[model samples]
Target: MELNSIKDAFDRVAKKQKLSCSKSQEVIDQIIQEIEKALGKIQPSLSDYKHVLSDLRTTLKDIAPLSQLEGTQKELNIALSKYAKVIEKSFNPDIAKAYRNIEFDVHTVNQIIAIHFYRQGFFDIGDCFISEARELESAASIKSSFLEMFQILEAMKHWNLEPALNWAANNSDKLKQNGSDLVLRLHSMQFLEILKKGSRNEALKYARNHLTPFSSDHMAELQKLMACLLFTGRLDSSPYSALISPTNWEKLAEELSKQFCNILGYSFESPLSVTIAAGVQGLPPLLKFMNVMAGKKQEWQTMKQLPVPVELDKEFQFHSVFVCPVSKEQSTDDNPPMLMPCGHVLCKQSIMKMSKNSTKSFKCPYCPSDVEATKCRQLYL
Candidate 1:
C-alpha cells in the first residue's frame, strides 16, 4: 500500500513537470513567432516599421502562459516535497539505532563486499576496491572460479554451448551424482540449434552422439526429440514444437548457474546479495519491534534475542533450527537439541533441568511416556 502511494506521488510530480515544460516551451515559441513576424515586416531602406514592432512587443507582453507555467512549476516542487515526506514517513531513519551497539570489522567486510563484486563479473570495480582496501590476496584466491563462470555464462548468452559442454563433460560424474541433467539439456539445445539451421542429417548425428546416453532416464523427452526429426525442415510446425520455446534457453541458463555454483560449493547468489536480501526482509519487523520497545521504555539492546520472530522466505533459510518447547529457548551449541525416547526434541539444558540434573526419569512434556535424560541422544541439524 505504501509502495502504491509512493508510485502515485511520483506520477503526480511527473505530470506536473511535463505540464511545466510544455507551458515553458509554448511561451518561448510564441515569443519567437512574434519576433519573426516583426522582422518580416521590417523595411531595410526605411525605419518606419515602429508600429509593427510595437504590436509584436504588445503581443509578447500579453502572453498569459508565464503565469500558468509558474503555477505548474510550483505545483511540481510541492509534489516533489510531498513525495520526499512520504518516503521519510514510510522508512524509519532511526532503525539504525538497533545496531548502534554492535561492532563491525571494517576490513573483513570490505574484502567480502569486494569479493562479491568480483564474483558478479565486475572485475575492474572489484580490482580497484581490493587495491584500495589492501585485500589483494583474498580477491585473488576466488577470482579464477568466478572468471570461469562468467566465461561460460557469456558464451551461453551468445547461444554458444561449447564451453558449457566442456565444463559439464569434465564434471559428468559429479553432475550425475547431484541429479543434474545439464549435459543432456545442453545436448538437446545443440540438437535444436542444428535442426533450426536445416541440417537434418547433422542433427540426427549429433543426437545419436550426445542424446543417446540419456535414453534410459529421459525416454519420453528423447522420444519427443526424435519426433522432431520427422518434421525435418518444418520442426516449427511439428507436434514437438513446444520444445523450441524461447523460455527454454532462459531455463537452461538458470540451471547452468545453479549447477555451476553447486560444483564450486558456492551459493547460486552472491553471499553479499543474500545477506542484503535477508536483512531487507527482516528489517521491517525489527524496526517495528524496536519502536514498541522504545515506547515501553524497555531495554531492547540488552535482550538476548528478539521477542518476536522475523519470518523470512524459504530461500533465506540456510539451515534447520530447533527451539525448546519446554524452556522457550533456542537450541545453541552450548545447549544442543536432543531427542528423547518418546520422539520429542528439547534442548539439552531443558531436559537436564526437567530431569533434575539427570538424577531421575521424567515424563515427556507432550507425551505420557516416561524417559530418562541419560537415554536422550543429541540431534544434529
Candidate 2:
C-alpha cells in the first residue's frame, strides 16, 4: 500500500511538473513573438530608431510578458516544492530502524550471491565474484549448469533450437517426473518453424519422430498444431493465425528456462531476485511498525517477529504458512501445527497450553471431543 501511494504521489508530481513547464513555455513563446514583432517594426524604421524604441517600450508594457512569465515560474516553483514534500511524506527516511543486526555466514552469503549471478546468466561476473570470495571451487558445478542453460537461451535468440532440443531429450525423464511437457513443446515449435519454411513433408516427418511420444497425452494440443500445417507458408492468413504469434516465442523461451531450472532443482527466479522482490513488498509494513514502536519507546530490532502482519503477494509465497486458529500465531519449527485425532489442527504450543503439556485432557476448541497433546501428531504443511 505504501509503495502504491508513493507511486501515485510521484505521478501527481510529474503531472504538475509537466503542466508547469508547459505553461512556462507558452508564456516564453508569447514573449518571444512580441519581441520579434517589435524587432520587425524597428528593422523597417532604422531612420526613426528613437521613435521605434519608444513604441517598443509601449508595446512591452501593453503585453506585460514579464508578469505572465513570473506567474508561470512561480507555479513551477510551487509544484517543485510540493513534489519534494510529497516524496518526503510518501517514504520514511528512517528505514534503517526496521533492520535487525544479526550474524550471517560470509561463505554462505558469497555462495548465494555467486549463484545468483550465475543463474541470471552473468557468467563472467559470477566467476569474478566467486573468485574474489574464494568460492570458485564450491560454485563451479552450479555455474556449469547455468552456463548450459544460457547457451540454450543464446541459441534461442538467433532462432536456433538444436541445443535446446538436445538438452530436452537428455532430461526427458526428469521433465516427465517434473510434470513438464517441454519435449512436446520444443518439438511443436520446431514443427511450426518447418511449416513456416513451406516444408510440409519435413514438418510431418519431424512431428512423427519427435512429437510422437506426446501424441496420446496431448492429442488436443497436437490437433491444433497440426491445423497450422494447412496454411504452410501463409500461416499469418490462416484460421490458425495465432499459432505464429510473436508472443509464442517469448512464452516458449520462458517455459524452457523454467523447466531447465526445475530439472536442476532450482526455481526459475534467482533467489536474489525473489528475496529482493519479497523484501520490497514487506518493507512498508516493517517501516510503519518501527515508527509506531518509536512513539512507545520500544525496541523492535531485537524482536523475532513484527507486531503487524506483512501481507505479500501470492508470487512471493514459496511454502505453506499455517496460522494457529487458537492463538492466531503463524506456525514455526518450535510451534509446528499439530493434527488432533478429532481432525482439528492447532499449533503445538496452543495444544500444549490447553492440555497442560499432555498431563490432562481438555475439550477441543472447535469440537466437543476431549483432546490430549500426546494424541496430536505434528502436521507438516
Candidate 3:
C-alpha cells in the first residue's frame, strides 16, 4: 500500500510539470498504455512530438510592463506637439495641413502661422497687425507704439499726422529716458526729413525744440544738419560761421563736387569756394594728380611726356628721365629710343634693318639671342 502511494505521488508531480489537466491526464494515460502495449509488436522507434514542451514553459516569464511603455508614448506626444508648429509653417500647403491636424495647443501654432503668412508675402505689416488684433480680440495702443509710429511715418507725407508728431514731440523726454538708441535715430532722421520742407524759422525752431541736443562727439551729425540747412537755403552763410572752418570748408567742397557731379555731369576740378560736407576735407592723392594734370598749360598738356634721353653711350645705351604717361608728345626734341630686352636702345633705322630679315629671325642688336619677333608688340610711338 505504501509503495502504491509513492508511485501515485510521482505520477501526480509529472502531470503538473507537463501542465496536463485532470481530464486530459486520464486520456494521456490511456494513450501511453496503448502505446506501451503496441511497442512489443511495433518494429521502429519515433519521437513523441516535434516541439519541446520545456521551451514552451520557458517563454511564459518575460512579459513587458504597460507603465514604462505608457511613459514613452507620453514623451513622444510632447515631442510631436513641438515639431508640429514648425512643420505647419512650411511653404508646402499639404505639409501645413498635415501639421494642423496634429493635436497641440493653438496659441504658438497660430503665431507661427501668422509669421509664415508675413514671410510668404501674403500680408503687409499694417494688415498683419490688423489681422493679429482681430484674431486675438484685443485693442492695440495707437500712439508711439512701434507699429503705430512706423505706419505714421509710412503715410506721413500724404497723411497729416500732426497728432502723431505732437505725441512724439511731447514724449521726447520720456523717449530719451526709456527708448532705445535705434528709436532715437529713427526719430532724428524723420525730424530732419520733415524739417527739410518747413519754413526757415519754423524748421529751425522745430528742429531745436523736438530733436535731442547734439553731442560734441557727434560732430558729424551736427555738420550734416548744418549742411542740410545751408543746402536748402534755410540759413545764410553768416549763421553757419561757427560750423565752417577751413578744413570743414574743404570737406564741404568735395561733398558738393561729388553731389553736383552725380546730379549734373562733371565734378569741379577744384573747390567752388562754397560750403561742402565736413568729412572730405583732405584731397585724395588721385584728385591731386588729376588737378595737376588738368592745370597743364603747355602743348604736352593733352599728351603723355615720354622718357627723355639725358645721356647716351657709344654702345647705344641711353639713360632717360622718367615722366608721366599722360605727357608724351612726338613733337618733343628730346625723344629717346626705346630700350629692348637686351637693355640697349636702337634708333628707327636699326628697327627697320631688323624688319628686313625674312630668312632669319631678328636678333637683338647688342646680344646674339633671337628677338622672338613673332611675340613682339608694336611700339606705341
Number of clashing residue pairs in every model? 0, 0, 10
lDDT of candidate 1 over 273-370, digit per residue (tens): 99999988888888887776776434776666667788999999989978899888878878999999989999999989989999999999898999
Error of 1 at 72 (Å): 9.6
**Per-model CA lDDT versus the true structure:** 0.85, 0.84, 0.42
Give the winner by lDDT: 1 or 2.
1
RMSD of each: 5.0, 3.2, 34.5
Report the lDDT tens digits of candidate 2 across residue range 1-381: 746766766676677678767877887787688778778887877887777778777877887767766765676677667767777877778778777777999998897899899988888999999888988678989999999989998898878889999998899899889888788878888898899889999998988888877877999999998888788998888888777687887888899999988888887788888898998888888887777787653456556655689999999887899999999998888899999989999999999898888899998989999887787999887
Residue 81 in candidate 3 has what lDDT?
Answer: 53
Per-residue lDDT over 1-381 for candidate 3, one digit per residue giving the tens place of the 0 to 100 score: 534555555554554434434434555465455556455434354353223333323322222223424544455455455445444432224211111123656654454444333323345653565565464442132211334433443444343445444644665565455432333343444444454465556656656764546544456765666455654433334454334234543443333223323332222322222212211232232233443454443432333532232222333322343332323333233433444556544443344457563334577755786654333433434
- lDDT sort, best first: 1, 2, 3
Residue pairs in collision within model 1: none
* lDDT-superior candidate, 1 or 3: 1
The TM-score values for the models, in the order shown, are 0.74, 0.85, 0.26
Candidate 3 yields a Cα-based lDDT of 0.42
